[model samples]
Target: MTATTTTLRVGTRGSALALAQSGQVADWLSSTVGVPAELVRVRTEGDVDRGPLATIGGTGVFVTGVRARLLSGEVDVVVHSLKDLPTAAADGIALAAVPRREDPADVLCARDGLTLAELPDGARVGTGSPRRAAQLRAARPDLDVRAVRGNVDTRLGMVADGTLDAVVLAAAGLARIGREDAVTERFTEDVMLPAPGQGALAVECRLADRHTGPYASALARLDDPVSRAEVRAERSLLGALEAGCSAPVGARAHSDGVRLTLTGLVIAPDGRRQVRGEISGRAADAALLGRRLAQRLFDDGAAALLGDLPLRAAAAAGGG
Candidate 1:
């Protein structure tokens, strides 16, 4: 379709964060690509079910419905929170772009501007990620960690209403929805590692249109090479481990002009055991770097921590 005759429909979940990000994508397409675009809200099972993510199929639950719409030609493009996307590629879909990523750190939103270290012992902390729960427990074993599910405001409300003393949330999610003021402290990577592709947005289109078309032109203009390389390395680690996004696994990657460095972490559900490894190589070797790091962590005892768990068996009942 020609740019003049086509109005691109960008698919996204209806959540506040999803809409906010999708709206940004739409605006970018209009301003940069000169292709007028509209947001198409897709209802996903993840948004409907209040059950724990692991119990309902983990990583892809939030993405499956939106993807179906894309495959069916109901939408010309789809924007997804990269971390929610599965490491396994879908057959006919192409990840056309990864825009510049947001901050991937986890943040602590406490009741009284309290930082993580200042929270009293036995204080109740809420989160919806197995990775966060495990890391938090490792950092503060005396605190009472609770599993939680809901939108950002709903989870933050737990702290406001005394249901939880603090809630750990993605820094990127808060930033996207203009809710960063709710954050009491931003956890450094030393304290908590983000999930693979966390803080990045994935722009997808049908494989057939990926190489040719106005959609392809828009996608090419939207993709950021740096962000693409970083996520490729991180997601590669997740894929190599064969762990769902909800698994108690964490990965982060950084690129220094000449080389890409990746770090992989695996923690036992109980937080009593852990393994971490790092690898660096040319950014062009991002995928291989991730696999190498994963193998290193496995040799260092991560395999035992992960082997006993089921594919989507998130030790903590949570959502992210």
Candidate 2:
């Protein structure tokens, strides 16, 4: 299809970060494929509800609306924050591309420039993610970990207004929103392993569109082999674990084009118990490496550690 014959409609959530990420993709599509691309803002249930994420649903909440639009032919393509996407595959849709990733580390956006360790006892740390909360408690048992939910600016506003001493957020989100300077410190991987597919964007299209659609060539240009391999390994681990976004699980994968290494962590919600493991293999065996590492973690008592959490069950059911 020629540029004048097709206008690629890219659907995205109507959030600042989502717009920023989708805008970048739209521009790339237009320039690279010589096709006119436009952004279609889709409001998700997650965006309308202000309750805790786990209570409303899990990560899939942000994706359902947009995916429906893609499947219904309202949009030709969609962009998603990789971390917000469930590990399970959706029928009728395909992940066509994963562009180069940004830094996947979680960062401390603390007031008064206080690092996690330097914060006073009982410091109020705001985060809605179970993984971040568990890590915070594990590192500083004295902290007052509070459940807070909002967009990036709203979360930052709490700290700016003295309602929260600090807030834990993805370094990638902050950087994408041009607020990286607000980060007090980017936590080391040992301190806080990032979520599966964090710091990446998932560009998806209808399964039927991947090979013969007008947007196929443009989407193909966005795929980064290294990022795709690394995120695939991490997400494969998550899928094997049968854990959802609400589970206190952390994973990060790295690839040097030839070899890939994946680290997986599962921590008790109360931060009392944790299991960690790592596996390395040829980059071509990324998915296998992730599954193997997950099995190792289960052998290390990850199942028992997570068995009692109702949130895990809720996430699984919601994803279905």
Candidate 3:
């Protein structure tokens, strides 16, 4: 396909990490597709609200506005952190691509370059994610886990200024913002499983533009099949469980061309109880494998554990 002369407008949130990620995509589109690409910053409710994510809304708050612009023909494309996207399908938007994934593990940004195990008893850890909080408390029952809100720099600043002993954040976000130096320890999957679809980017376009759009072919070229398959399994599990992105649930999946392995976990908010399960099958059965594993967890009492938590739709609508 020949490159078009028209400029493509990529919608994105104005946050530093969002800008960094979207800027990378725009550059790639310009260079690889020989088309001019510009970023259009779109403010989101998540950015404007200073309250807790749980109270304000869980997933989709950051994405809803950008998606609205895309649907309204205000932008040609939008980039999102895949983990922040809800498991439910959007009516008019198509996930055009999932580029190669980054390290999906959670990292600890701690004081004095201390690791998780090196922290002293009663050390305070800050995180806004229930998954991270539960994992931290599960691993270190003595540590003080506190809820924190803000951007990556703000959270890291707290640790640097001695307001908190440590904070947990996605390594991919730090790397995207060129702040990897803030990470003191990268937790392995065994120690800390990542949220579903973590470390992946979703490039979305209007469903009607898949074939006739000038940039459709270019965006399609960015899709990585292996990454797509892995995240599909992970998100499928989340969908089957009916949990939001911020739920106290963790999942990770890996595919080696032929076989796919998935690990799923549910941890109590208090970290007093936990359940985990793993399953492997043909890579072609990714979605089925995810659902089956979730069913296994449910059979092991995952439903009972999650029954009391706020549903994704309710949380996203600020009903929580």
Candidate 4:
């Protein structure tokens, strides 16, 4: 019997940060499975369009093309920032592993040195994320929140060049590419719980490939069980709320030995109404934690605030 020689194809975006992240996985594969590797770059619609993300839709816009490559056998595996993936898995697609998370908090970079507390009345704050925009508005109702969309450097440039007073971004992404010093202060969970799966990375492969199994298992070595449970709980909360990724929902889950605690927040667009909650349960019962928290919030009239928007517009926009 002859063994088939294999060099796994890893698909990723062409951006500097995307390549760096994919490189981390490829390096891990080579060391663990002793297999040669190659990177297949794909251009996502998100990359081609310099328009506002709101116009293009949110979440998965950066991932769909690479996911297609995975399904088509063009690439054996794909790398993604976990937040870019929806809580619901697509048909024929599954996530094999979620690596240990990076920092899961939004950061404020202010040129005027105004902290979230110090921003003057009617101050202009910039952010591409509805999650951040809503939360910032909820936190400081006095300031003016506006939309600004682009990659990290582009958004940061708004602050650097004095186009905006300050902007919010994921702390993990900044740290990933050596931009940590740009973070003025990391928002506390009460102020800005991160989006579901914000700081994690998901490496995916086809369901039953024997060769890729070894490499996938190698990547799974980096998975943090506690982070996995916490992120899973947070994703479940978002899913139950039926909130689009653009919805102003932020959450964090943590575990202490046998108990898992989930904290959730929902804020209105104008920053006037904010609802927050926390529930503790057995670490093994993530779904229960999410369900109970959502139910309690619903009893508190969360559903009244969440109107059923056109699902068609949402799906077309992106399952964000």
Candidate 5:
């Protein structure tokens, strides 16, 4: 159906967090572009699998299934947790926009409103992300870091039930689902840098619709330049490192309209060895800045730290 005559079908994973974010996008399209938009839930492999993310294909697991729906013309647009998107671009699909971003910091949901530092020695903390596990271990080597998987509520329930003393989650995810009050403490970048593109939403459509369709204008207007630049820089570093989304890698970028600053980190899964680097350049050079920083990280021995990861990449000429 033509976008002009029919409602814009926005495809999304059926998870509560996904629906909340996708619903926001759909509502925006309806209100801003005057096009009726509908939510079309798509079940993904990641949703069905209870296995650890890295073992089951990491970053692309949550994305591939929903993207297939977009490619098959079943939906006009798809919304994704930007962190779940692979650095590789999908053929025939366009990342039409990255709307305004949420706070990308990760937070600790601990019992007794305790902050990270307040946790007693040997405290049990659960997280599904290797990056978070590494950083958490690094920050408090005495504490126990456990791998746990489930939806946000399930993870949080573990804490409520005393199964886990605490859990680490994306601040944005908690915010989107109206559970911000559960956060006991927000980790600073120095303590726990976030995953690249963690707090953003990706709006994608078929490549052809990007420049010539009823949705084109709305997509263009939806893109926030600063947010896009920030994520581009972060994702570029991830791509340059050749690391999968579930790798023990963390990056954060900020663009203040004119200039951009990016930081990249690579830590061993065990949190013993790590390398971190930072770079700044023109905001327009976000991607270049990322590659440059990644190269710096490699030069600082980041590669050795990644050797044991499930997904490892040899160091290459950065900014190639």
Candidate 6:
């Protein structure tokens, strides 16, 4: 198989972390397939606005621009954090690859080196995601959770300055930018289930849009088949729930040799109650595993908890 040596544009959001992740993708593509790939920085509406994310459109404001560039042929490939990709696929585009996954759980970045348990009552924990915020409240109902927004660096700075006692961040985002030191503690699966597809990368490309065909295929060699299956199941759960990306839902999927297991949760905003369910099935029926989990939860009263969210949850928090 021949590799493409000509220039290939890879579009990515222009955040420090986004660029770093994109650079890693470019490095993998170039070294694995002999394609000369460069990162094309794109400014997204999410990056420009400092307002509340929920008030603005919640359709992953970060990845839309990059996807547009890919659709227009301005870039041959676009790499995005899997959590940022919508459950709905775009027309003319395919999620060609999912290149493994990192720690999918949220991490706590606290001041004075305190863990979630060591923190005092009424201590402020900052987060923008409803799932994290609801989980924080559930874990420590006495603590205060403020909605926070910004790039990873900006949010971490709040803890550094003592404005916030702690913050919840995606472990993968911390790892991508060499900011693992920012984490005071990694939330365990039992305590805080991650957002669906939280730690993987989605490689999007047009259907049969090959740049030096065989080389393109080889570069995609980085995709991990098992991780792809896990994310598919988790995303299917999200789709079945009809919850937007901002909804207070948490899901995780794991596969052993014999079966795939999916655990899902829907939390009320006040943290007093939540609905949880799990399902196991043949690995080949991962999507069914997710749907089954959803059906069980709904039958068990998840709909009442998530229905009319305001009665179930609080108003959105913070401006970034």
How would you encode candidate 4's per-residue C-alpha lDDT over 1-320 as one tens digit per residue? 12226886889998877888888887777666777789899999888986765556666688888999988989878999887876667766667767778888889987756688887788788987777887887788777788876778888888888788888888888888888888777899878888878888888887765235545566567666777788778878877887766667788888763789999877666667777889999888987798789787777777755553333246433476
Per-residue alpha-carbon lDDT of model 1 for 1-320, expressed as tens digits? Answer: 24556787999999899999999988988776666789999999998988877778785789989999999999989999999988877889999999999999999999989998999999999988889999999999998999999999899999999999999999999999999999999998888999999999999999998998566876797898888999999988887777788888998999864689898899987777899888889999999899888888878987788787676333222222
Lowest lDDT sum, 10 consecutive residues, model 5, at 311-320
TM-score of each: 0.95, 0.97, 0.96, 0.90, 0.96, 0.93
Candidate 5: lDDT over CA atoms?
Answer: 0.90
- The TM-score leader among the candidates is 2
Q: Which 10-residue window in model 3 sums to the lowest lDDT?
A: 311-320
- Candidate 1 lDDT at 170 equals 92
Name the TM-score of candidate 2. Answer: 0.97
Please provide, for model 6 over 1-320, each residue's C-alpha lDDT reduced to its tens digit, 9 standing for 90 to 100.
Answer: 46666776889998888898888888888777666788999988788887766666553777788889988989888988887776666778778778878889899999988999999989999999888888888989999899999889999999989899999999999999999998899999889999999999888887666443444575458788788889888988877776666778899999763578899999887877899988888878888888888899899988887786541222122111
**Worst window of 10 by summed lDDT in candidate 4:** 308-317
User: Model 2 off-target regions past 4 Å?
Assistant: 314-320
lDDT of 1 at 13: 96
Candidate 2, residues 1-320, lDDT tens digits: the string is 45546787999999999999999999998887777889999999999988877777787899999999999999999999998887778899999999999999999999999999899999999999999999999999999999998889999999999999999999999998899989998999899889898899999999998988887877887899999999999989888888887678999998999999899999987787899999999999999999999999999999998787666665555471
Predicted structure 1: clash tally:
0
Predictions in order: lDDT: 0.88, 0.90, 0.89, 0.77, 0.90, 0.82
Clashing pairs in 4: 245-320
- Model 1 compared with the native: what TM-score? 0.95
Lowest lDDT sum, 10 consecutive residues, model 6, at 311-320
Candidate number with the higher TM-score (3 or 4): 3
